[model samples]
Target chain A: MPYTSDKPPLPETPEQLRVRIPGWGVDLDPADRPAVPRERFDPGATGAHWEFPERQPEERPRERSIEHGTLPPVFGTTLPLRGVSGVVRRYAYRRFSEARAAHWLLLMAGDRIDVVESRVLAAVRGRPDDPVAETGVRSEVSHHGWSSRAGAGRADVVHQPMDPVIVAGPWVLGGLAAVVVARRLARRARRR
Target chain B: MRAMVYRGPYRVRVEEKPPPRIEHPNDAIVRVELAAICGSDLHLYHGLMPDTRVGTTFGHEFIGVVEQVGPSVERVQVGDRVMVPFNVYCGSCYYCARGLYANCHNVNPNATAVGGIYGYSHTCGGYDGGQAELVRVPFADVGPAPIPDWMDAEDAVLLTDAVATGYFGAQLGDIVEGDVVVVFGAGPVGLAAAQSAWLMGAGRVIVVDHLEYRLAKARELAHAETYNFAEHRDVVVLLKRVTDHLGADVAIDAVGAEADGSLLQHVTAAKLKLQGGSPVALNWAIDSVRKGGTVSVVGAYGPIFSAVKFGDAVNKGLTLRMNQCHVKRQWPRLFEHVRNGYLRPRDIVTHRFPLEDIAEAYHVFSAKLDGCIKPLVVPGPA
Candidate 1:
């Protein structure tokens, strides 16, 4: 079943409606852009956490400010993303306008593709007060195809991925290419 | 009386300082009424400034009533309210003749780094700052902007660095009507960048930062669309998402550090981790820009060589422009903007502290506590 908004819907603010949301909205180039499934994404096992690392206290550290110059990275990653859950949660909240705009980190571990949807479900099912603050997602009863998970902990949540979505794009694309090429080679070998 | 002495590295003291008197023909001795702790001043505070002479006064962002002036001084008279240009220029050199006062070679020959400025460092012409009760400003006619009768000194203090830097970014980026501009690092410079971009006719401006309070303020004050970088890992992708597949026409990097490296690390670390002077955000800016776009880096850079892949920038056909803001050239227009109520850089100030409470002020600014954007230091009674 296609996912639908589960909350009481209201009119979008002028800013929200006029906002030029690229990949998610009217400007989305359908050929290149994937259809975002409405069903609740299940974070089957991985639970992502936004870790705010504590900075060591500087008691009386030297305060010399230096002139930082800029060149560019010699061997930096072409990929721009870093944390996985961070990006997913960011998109989930952004696409679903009703969700609180604050940092709602996605915590999930599952199949790479599944985790994306799961993270949004995690935000919706568990985040009752904020209700994932989605715009149109709240209009339907079973927006995620699954009722809210109650006390869903260890059995469902895991942490191996640590925001696995960071590598989702490249990893998924690379695997698909490998499978396609492998199939072609297998077909040639069978014909010979 | 002794001045607040910069004894050595990591050492400065407010000593019983002798009062300064006008020295040069165009000099003016002014009693500093309000001197704020500047982000640049933190360089001297942390003893990061090299070859910095001890016993030098250190505050530069200040407003005061001119107490005395030299024979040649005409623009400012005694008892007139004024604020000195942080970028102290001769106002007559070849560079100054072209309105590039920040690059006045005569005032700062060794200052190949930044044209020249008061209270910065040897690289900035090594003049003492206004942190002291009294400061002597040279080339007074060409540099200081007279405070208007109606303007509040507290609000006007920002014109010194923050607003000037913003104007510089907007000017260099060539902000035009209906343009989309993105300013990275919503610090004072970024906020100023948004304001200036709007003033220059950008149809939409987006400010990216990790701090929510600052983003809120940027949205409220600069009339910009704010993005929380903390929320998205791929800033370029997120920005592209917002700008209809074409990134901002101009992207300004107000933050000037490697991804996780700093100027100090490059200076001291044996076999420096990186070897060319490149900022990580510059690459991000490049990626965040649309085709044939420009990236303006106006952030204060420290002396360090981190390797930058020039090939990528070149191949991308990106035009990277950077310079210490030429304040003298743009100050008149900026000040006019302030006078006419067309600009208000003061909206960024979330905290104000007395000079006596210096430590607390630093704490708030450094910690970014409570939406602290611009922290003003009141040297004396407000």
Candidate 2:
């Protein structure tokens, strides 16, 4: 690819940044919104939407090698969706996975941790309307978002919406810290 | 006088430009006699052409007189009236031998994988266009052919691009005898393709375009059955209804970015109006073709990669073919056709303007004003 010298102009202020890199469709005014508390982080929040994607039964699993990585689950000629989201969100966390012929890892991220968790939950809860598609959990992390390290094996995700956001970490801690500071300032203004 | 050079998207300048000198040993300088504004030329003006460096003159199609020739160039003498093939290619490349002159490696390395042409982009060897008063033709001995004594400069200009491309489209589409052909897009290329298809023995040549004037031109000048895509929403149904539901054997996309709005700033619409979203005639062509039919796309598309549902293509088993017209392969044959009176490529030249009034010409072409098909630009006698 040729080097791109043209870049769209960037936002200068935090308000502008928030408007641009919005997490989980959450509005900038978080005070009126339902916040996902840090303590409520659940690895199993994936619900019933989480199911191993239908794999072709005819193919045999490969033997593992220590030098390279673990062997992949070989399947018959069926091509599965790479991205399929959970049942509840229907098309939210588009989740689709296919067994790999080579080493690979599944990486997932949201604009923020809350958004990531919501996507994970959506992936777990298979869309009731379409039972054929389901999302499976390989691993979960709050701030790190979700990742499944299938030793040297590849997995493709379908319906995976790529959000343009450069987040530092989870939104819960950041939101809670801001809330505390705002309350203190309110108290000071009341005293004045 | 400064020559217009493309700086960036929508950016062009005519500064105190240096005189174009003969750069290579085989290069010959020709004072351009008649250079025309081509639809392909718009790709550069819009800054959509990738990697177009600054200081490149931006016209390709030309009819010129040989002012000077290199020591080794014995093919044409000075004052010889010639029409240079828009694409510059050495006569001795692998592709050139295979009659695929557009893909010549030495002239256009970037597009050599498929094929290359002139005044397009840097990937095509970064050769400056013929928009200026004088142009340097590299590989002069191989790239240019003399204009016949009977043919005028105005008539000869079309041989370089529109005529050649249209002829190529007809040949590539495999328009069989008595086959119904639908050419989508009514720009200069589309008009040329329609004429070529008619000449190549197609029983019916249906030209589809949204503009009424262009459709009128197709009917009046090219004698093609024209369809107003804007008024007629159902191209597939219409084609099927016209051809006993068998669709067309050959479908050519000559409109490219021009009539299809691919060259404009707007994203290509799924539907022309709000009726049903489909790529107008292209979709109809895809659906209207028989299972083993051929579809030739010579139109230029913009930056946005078009999303095509592959399922329809698979089921039809359609032989989709296209290439940037290899002027080297078809030019001689097309030139002969023109000479024989079988090909009337010059019929598409609806407007001509002086070099000083180029901006007005651009406005007309850009706005699709006054039934403009092909606008020829004469640089001198101002």
For model 2, residues B35-97, the per-residue Cα lDDT tens digits are: 888886765554444334444577779878888876656577789888888877655544454
Point out where model 2 deviates above 4 Å: A1-192, B11-13, B109-116, B258-281, B302-304
lDDT of 1 at A31: 25
Residues A1-192, model 2: lDDT tens digits: 013433222223334422422121121122211111102223122111112211213233221222222221111111111222112111221232112211111111111122334345445866221111111011022111222222211111110121111111233567788899999999999999
DockQ of 2: 0.01
Model 2 local distance difference test score: 0.55
Query: Candidate 1, B349: how far from true, in Å?
Result: 1.6
Backbone clash pairs in model 2 (N, Cα, C under 3 Å; residues 3+ apart or in different chains), count:
29
Q: Residue B216 deviation, candidate 2, in Å?
A: 0.7
- Sort candidate 2 into its docking category: incorrect
